[model samples]
Target: MDPVVLAAGSALVSAMATDGWQQTRAAVVEWWRRRRPDRADGVGSDLEAVRAQVLAAREQGDEDTEQALAGAWRLRLQQLINEDPALADELRRLLDEHVDPALSDGEQPQHRPIIMKAEARDNSRVYQAGRDQHITGS
Candidate 1:
């Protein structure tokens, strides 16, 4: 998937979990209104429905479901970009100016991949984590 699609999808999901989600949702809907007017009417309703699911999933401790919803959205965005290759720029702007800042921490895990490498030789040890790591026990 395109980086913008990945970031936007993940940020969109994160923002859905926040208190200011209505504004985020509205911004996305307006994007559709400008770029895909034909699909705009339904998009707001669809986003609201998705927001319900996101809340439900969070309540159920079902992060996977939330991720699946993001994937569905990513696919939707990818299709939009595919139809109009130039839309990628618009999507990037949406993600940057609106979607990402909506995140509580301004972090999009899917925005970039993390890779770690270590060579532990001669009684050495290596440990890595994308976020947090604790080594207890000497």
Candidate 2:
């Protein structure tokens, strides 16, 4: 499978689980709008249906179902790209510009970030913790 198709498919399903999914949905439909204009409307409707399934799966704690949905989309995108290899670039652009941002917004949680960096030389040890660290028998 094309990496771009994999990424776009993953992003498409991930975005469907987010509040900003409508934006990604629009971007996807628009992709069809440009190349397969006749299918654009149906694509949008299909995405909506997928979104509903995703939400329900999430609510039911059905990770497998969600993953299955992602897989289905991956195949769909691969088919699209198969028909027009040129679409790979466009799909990459859409994932970067539209889908990723929507994922970030939708997955935001009420938690602070934890950053840790370590550089060890000459058998030196570096330890960092965001919350707590306990070392014994050093």
Candidate 3:
């Protein structure tokens, strides 16, 4: 999947759970309106339905369901971009301007790289990881 689509889809799903979802939703539907005016209304309705489902899944503590919803939206966005290659830039702008800012308002996410290394000698072995790890020796 395109990285912009992936990021936008994730940001869309995250925005749906935030108070600024309406703004993000409007921006999405407006973009659709410009591209395919006939489908814009339906797309808006569908977005609402998806948002409801995402919220319900989150309430039920169903991470898998939420992820599946995100994947669905990602695919939809990918299709749109496939049809009109120019929309890719618009999606990126939406992410940077609307969706991402909404997500960052409360608490910024933390990202850290993880590195792992292993070495073995004739009669000994070593295993290491910055986080989780599993190892077997003989």
How would you encode candidate 2's per-residue C-alpha lDDT over 21-123 as one tens digit per residue? 7777888888789989998998899999999999999999999998899899999889999999998888877777888888775452223336777889998
Off by over 4 Å in 1: 110-138
lDDT of 1 by residue, 29-123 (tens): 99999999999989888888888999999999999999999999999999999999899999988887777777766455546458888889998
lDDT of each: 0.85, 0.82, 0.82
Best by TM-score: 1
Q: Tell me each candidate's RMSD, in Å, in order.
A: 5.3, 5.8, 6.2
Screening candidate 3 with a backbone cut-off below 3 angstroms (N, C-alpha, C), the clashing residue pairs are none
Model 3 misplacement above 4 A: 105-138
Q: After superposition, how far is residue 47 of candidate 3 from its true place, in Å?
A: 0.9
Report the error of model 2 at residue 81, Å. Answer: 0.6
Off by over 4 Å in 2: 105-138
Q: Judged by lDDT against the true structure, how good is candidate 2? A: 0.82
Residue range with the least summed lDDT across 10 consecutive positions in model 2: 105-114
Taking all chains together, each candidate's TM-score versus the true structure is 0.77, 0.74, 0.74
Question: Candidate 2, residue 110: CA error in Å?
Answer: 22
